[model samples]
Target: MSDVTANEVTIRQYRPEDVKYLMEYAEENEWDLSMYDHLAYTRIDPNYLIVAADKDDVPVGFCGVSQNAPDTIYFGNFIVRKDLRKRGIGRLLWKAMLEKAGDQNIVLDGGPEMADWYITHGFPYQAYKVQFYAVKVNDEMKQNIMFKYDTKTLMESMWPDLMKYDSQVYTNFDRTRLLRAWFTGDDVRVAVAMEAGKIVGYGSIHRKPNGEYGLRNIFGDNEDVIEALLHNMLSVLPEGTVVHFMMPEDKPLPKYIQHSMKVEETAVRMFNKVKIETNNEKIWFATAHTV
Candidate 1:
């Protein structure tokens, strides 16, 4: 292992054949990642991810780039082989990411321990830390549930205003295209909460490659709207299904969600060039991939 120098690896565009090897490295690190979840991103931009290949052209590390807005780029899916640390492969991937991102604002979530490195590199502002939690759904928690608002699924008629609401909350970008892509798959479900004939909140959920479901973009104006959107989204899924979601470190989960959830991971949210404004108090985060 000591003889394996960082020079032995070279950065290159990701290939279809490299998916299996990349997934293996990700799984070995216990990452909740799947090609199915990232498909929306790659479909929109094929060059969204890059890999560091060994001397033999075998991918040993990876990084991903996604422009959530005209001025914002999010870097994620960072990994080097579990046994291949300290050889500068990750730095190579980082340099490549910087090159791709150019002068746009760079936003990313990374390990707390590595904050200093990122700060020195470029990202120097802290927005907030976040927790990604995993929990399973069952009939037991469905009791005493009340829907405070009427929930509507995504439709052709809802496009204009839906984008407006999402843009208002997310603030950095208009996710019309991204949201459309995320809400399209057969297994995906989307809900918009309404009260007094007005939009209050919205959410979405879908099955991941690992059989667990990803609850995406649960944004609401208040706890009531959040609760309704969450319950309606969950009610459609079968029992015994595991779901992954995110929350800011300062905010607790709504009082009514009656499941024992575990924090799957933690990372500090950071930005360079600018700290984008979001309605942080009102939104339950989804994936940092686009946020």
Candidate 2:
């Protein structure tokens, strides 16, 4: 274990050259780091990512905050060397990252173990955990539940209404840049529920490193729309694929989905300044880092 002193730790903006060290740290600590996530964060303004380096200029920790929207910034990628905890390295990285956002509201998706520490820094927990659920997509599920609602591929022109719907559910932070990147990614597949030519729900599946699919930002006004969006997403994929989604603990899960889905994981979603309202029923999934 490395005994990194407070004075020896330095927090600064991340650079492209630091990825190799970050990847090694992530692998060493069993963090769920992926190339897609790294690429997405890199695409953002470089100033949003802050790295904590030891006296030798080796990366020991990192924290990222995305202020794509004017009034809000979402903090993520918060990690420090396991042996370096309780030494204020995380605090230094966090405080520096927070400074990048100025007065914008800061939102964080943290773990229960670190919830109290974050609250002490002014970001309070919302009294719930983000529930992660996963299920194997077999032929029977596709046949029985996926054929109920109609859906179509989402387009760039529809971003206006989509943004409105998202704003209503998420309550803060516009995902314009982030959604644009997601919808435009070659490996990402997006589907929207359509009723009388109006979109009622939307869902997107991102290709994972292991060849499975990961659901991102699945939300709808009703079960039909939500199911339709899911069906549209799965219809294009091969059979026997595994899909994973994360939802708020309070969000209602259908009996069939609940039966088919297992609790895969959990994380605490916290925010500073004020709590944001979300439609628990409408939200079926959230991204791990971008929330």
Best by lDDT: 1
The sequence of per-residue lDDT tens digits that candidate 2 reaches over residues 80-129 is 87788888888798778867878877778877777888888888646357
lDDT of 1 at 211: 73
Q: Output the worst ten-in-a-row residue range by lDDT, candidate 1.
A: 255-264
lDDT of 2 at 16: 82
Give candidate 1's error at residue 150 in angstroms: 0.5
- Assess every candidate by TM-score: 0.92, 0.85
Name model 2 segments beyond 4 Å from true.
Answer: 1-3, 20-33, 125-128, 142-148, 171-173, 259-264
lDDT at 142, model 2: 62
Where does model 1 exceed 4 Å of error?
1-4
**How many clashing pairs does model 2 include?**
0
What TM-score number comes out for model 2? 0.85
